[model samples]
Target: MKKSYRIKKDVEFQKVFKQGASFANRQLVIYYLHKNDQPHFRIGLSVSKKVGNAVERNQIKRYIRQAFTELQCEIKNEYDMIIIARKPVKACNYHEVRRSVEHLLFKTKLLNK
Candidate 1:
């Protein structure tokens, strides 16, 4: 994901965690907060050490990023989003990761149809 599209600061993630509405499935949890001033989307991903060692964690993050990239056009702007990987995600593959991400987004009811 591009720097411009990612939520990089600790403050940003904390804000989303504290104030955003959330949705989750077995593999992913998504939090989102709408904003009128931003006019763009900011995505933050959290794949913790508990999910696996470094390689597995990085691979899962990559899969989630790719899934978000594919769905970028279909998602509305002006929102801050945080995606957290669940423990079961350690054993999954790309397609499954993508499906999990998409499923969580759908549950949010904020994605463009």
Candidate 2:
């Protein structure tokens, strides 16, 4: 994942949380807000402490990031995305996590045909 294209600022995360529309599934929650002229789709990931300890949380975040990075090219332009991991995601393997994210993105119409 490219650092330059990631949602690194606190304000960006907060804005998305406050204003973006959300899509929820068993494994993840996706929050998205359209941007007028974004350079690329920027993503933020959140895994709560309720999901696990630091190690488990980091693992979940890593899996989410990896899936997003792999799918970035297929995603459309001018959108900010935030993916929130659920508890089930921690126990899930790579393919499961990938599919969950992909499914949500597809359902959200972020991926072009």
Candidate 3:
């Protein structure tokens, strides 16, 4: 994903968390804020150390990012989304992570039909 497509700032993430609507499944929690001026969606990822060691956390983040990359065209274009990995995600593979992400997006009605 491009740097421009990511939500990297602490304040941005907090704004999304505080003002956005959220949805979740067993593996992940998603918080989203609609941004009318945005031309494309931006995503923030959070994978805590409680989920695993540094390597494991990075792997989970990679999988989530890859999932977003693949689903970009199907996602709404004007939202800021934050994805927080749950502890159960440590045991999940890429496919599962992708499915969980897809599920959350669907639940939040952020995916195009």
> Taking the tens digit of each residue's C-alpha lDDT, what string does model 2 give over 1-113?
88966888899999999999999999899999999887889998888898999988988888888988888789898899998888888789889999999999999999976
Residue 75 in model 3: lDDT: 97
lDDT of the candidates, in the order given: 0.88, 0.89, 0.95
Q: Is candidate 1 or candidate 3 better by lDDT?
A: 3
Q: What is the lDDT, from 0 to 100, of the residue 67 in candidate 1? A: 93
Model 1, 1-113: lDDT tens digits are 67799999999999998998988889888989988888678899899888899989889889988998999988888899999999999889899988888788777876798
For 39-103, candidate 3 gives per-residue lDDT tens digits of 99999999988999999999999999999999999999999999999999999999999999999
Arrange candidates by TM-score, descending: 3, 1, 2
- Which structure is stronger by TM-score: 1 or 2? 1
Name the 10 consecutive residues with the lowest summed lDDT in model 1. Answer: 102-111
Instruction: Show where candidate 1 strays beyond 4 Å.
Output: none
**lDDT winner:** 3
The clash numbers for all candidates, in the given order, read 0, 0, 0
